[model samples]
Target: MTEIPKAADADSVTEPASASTLLARYLHRQRETILDGQIAAGAHDDPDAVADMVVAARRARGALAAHRKTARTQPEVHRLIEELRWFGITVGSAHELRTQAAWLLAAADLLRPRYVRGPVRARISGYFADRTRPAWIAGRELLASPRFPAMVEDLMAEERLLRSTVVPGIDDVDNTAVLEALLERVRSRMRAVESARGEDTRDAAMHGLRKAIRRTRYYLESVDDVAPARNAQACQGLAAVQDLLGGHQDAAVAKHHLMQIAREAENAGESTFTYGLLLQREIDRAAQYSAALPSAYWQALRGARVMADVHLGSAAE
Candidate 1:
């Protein structure tokens, strides 16, 4: 569970690291060691694994640079990388790189799931769901992350205690029990919201979906939990439709509450009707999200990627 650093903490740091710091310095250390530099500092039990991570990291860095420089979707693509390397540090190791790399790859899949699927998604997704990732780079002294300072650490830690994982819906096969539990939770949530869809329910559904998106985004690079590519476009489209409905839903909440207050005071219910109009519009918008009958993200991840990562002193495939 990687933490979210606060904006204030970033401001307090004395010297802000430029985006190039990791590439120019940290990754350089690993690459120089592996790709024909001096001997490694330690007697590596699994130098090959370390070497593979280094190679992967190098590839990711290269891909990111090229993607950002030439890809038509530079802003969105780069922003994802920027997120993966928010601490201004790119782990020169594989799990670290892939954990981060998988984020963009998976998102690209999700956003474009309707059109295609390949190394751009599935293989990357397989890397994502592999559970042994996070532990790998945790051992690297070079992986110091300023991404999450103390306060955010505590906040996230607390959250984990209350909730098993940020995204209980994560596609971790080993966590089948948790996955099933999460399914139940989602089913329950859907049922609750479906029943309450008229006014208050719509707002709640929007908020829940918003939370889901944020949680999914968080793991974009932290682990191999890549959302599948085949369902990307559908998910994005659903989100798109949901966004419009959300606007209407929010307005409905405000107006409905305000109008209720007015009616209670013997005022006309006219204003309430305005809110009802917005709410009904949201009802219409929601139809689009459900129109195509797209499957959940796990269906996509299975064909494309999985969720997991870790290990440093000795690594694995």
Candidate 2:
């Protein structure tokens, strides 16, 4: 575990003590999670380890994003952000494949006892086994990549810089201003989702909405100190919205994978019946989630507005 740097004492602070303390703690936690995640990924212990690493990677990414909003003025910070973004993209591919494998496995298990016979079950098992090999290979390649170690080194160096940098005007910026800025971002993302809905690519649009909801939720969580109750409620609302959209996206991805598997099965002269059946199930699941999306989106928007009016108003006073 990475040691959190000792924060400057409140008595010695030249700015608002509470704000500075919160910022320090957030950055420290971020650094620790990122380091821990890298360590876990490199261990290559078990299949479960991949999921744990992915969770840590996401938390670290969210923390980096939250911190960058205020720290982007520094050139080093800007470069680190871009590097981490690429790093995330690289690892995320493996994560996606792992997720799809899990989804397909669950679907196969669900159909095994009743619908699928021994032959079909064996084929499904074979398909998933082949699919997982590439994910594992990609993960190993990522760990061995020079960029992984470089990112860890850069993060540590940035931590040192954070400890020395005196954040100016911390006392001048009210919590309300922060909340308002975040709320505006949430609204903008909602509009983006709406616009995406009008585009020809529905799957991409739904994926974009899921990302927006995730970012909004992370931003809300980062500001829990500003207004604990309101932030917590808003986070819950956004999370619910995120879950709904995430399910839709997952179904779509699973359907695509199933289609590919069906094609491979046909090429191999194996029965594609089971794959076709699972594909139809995913289609239904996707449709079900899509039908629920409009209501969930509006509810989230209304909740966001209520939070803004209540919390932002209180902060102003």
Candidate 3:
């Protein structure tokens, strides 16, 4: 289980116990904020419910206000403290915390201490803590959840976001880092598949394509925000390639699922020609998908004006 970083990790500065207690309360309060929203919405038109809702609504808002103190307990707010130090990100109030949980997690990973120079680490860490944090968190969650159709849509949207944002920001040094990350993600997922075998191994390998596609989408979208805009059409074209591949993966998985159902039927002595035919259709789909994939996205990505934009004052204009 992922540990929720304690606010104390963000600061050595002494805090009032009252403050910590208040923050704890806030988490419980907002944890079911959606449920409260529904209740509040329903109560608005009920004369008898209005009084009760008013009290509940106030309590909810107050809970949020209290949690808004101290950034480190929640990942997003802690990044604003700009202290990569476990002791530096302690947030003091809701006003101090600006980002969300996903950003905080990503930023924490981004700021993992390294042998690199301190200022460089700080800057790179800042990138994840701020600009790309939400996407990183959400993308990781999406990648981990292997629903094929959703992954396909997410992969495509990620591609578009890159063309519009990520590639527009980066430095020459970081551009190399970007390419390395993209390649590494792809290779890592591919390796996951290569290392496994049997029905399980094949399933894992198929899942690797999902992971690769998502990571590729993230790196492209992320770094694009840091580099000068190139030809957007090129980016869209890359997305098209991923789309073809995604369709293949989806069909393959669906066909496999159908086969499982068919096998169960066969155990009872039923014919499964329909399931077999579905599997064939998926196989055909995969072949077509692989055929449509472009050679460019598959090649190593490099040579952008990485530092020409998105470094705050680093925009090359």
Question: Which candidate has the highest lDDT of all?
Answer: 2
| TM-scores for every candidate against the unseen true structure | 0.29, 0.76, 0.37
lDDT of 2 by residue, 68-170 (tens): 3454665666676666666665555666666777777778778856566336555656776776667666655765677666766676665444445654433
Worst-scoring 10-residue span by lDDT in model 3: 86-95
Error of 1 at 313 (Å): 21
Which candidate would rank higher by TM-score, 2 or 3? 2
User: Root-mean-square deviation of each candidate, in angstroms?
Assistant: 21.7, 4.5, 21.9
**What's the residue-level lDDT of 229 in candidate 2?**
78
Predict model 3's lDDT versus the native.
Answer: 0.37
Per-residue lDDT of 245-270 in model 3, one digit per residue for the tens? 55656656555544654565567575
Point to the candidate with the largest TM-score.
2
Worst 10 residues of 2 by lDDT: 1-10
Number of the candidate with higher lDDT, 2 or 3? 2
- Candidate 3, after superposition: displacement of residue 83 in Å? 23
What TM-score does structure 2 among the candidates reach? Answer: 0.76
lDDT (CA) per prediction: 0.35, 0.63, 0.37
How far residue 296's Cα lies from its native spot in candidate 2, in Å, is: 2.8
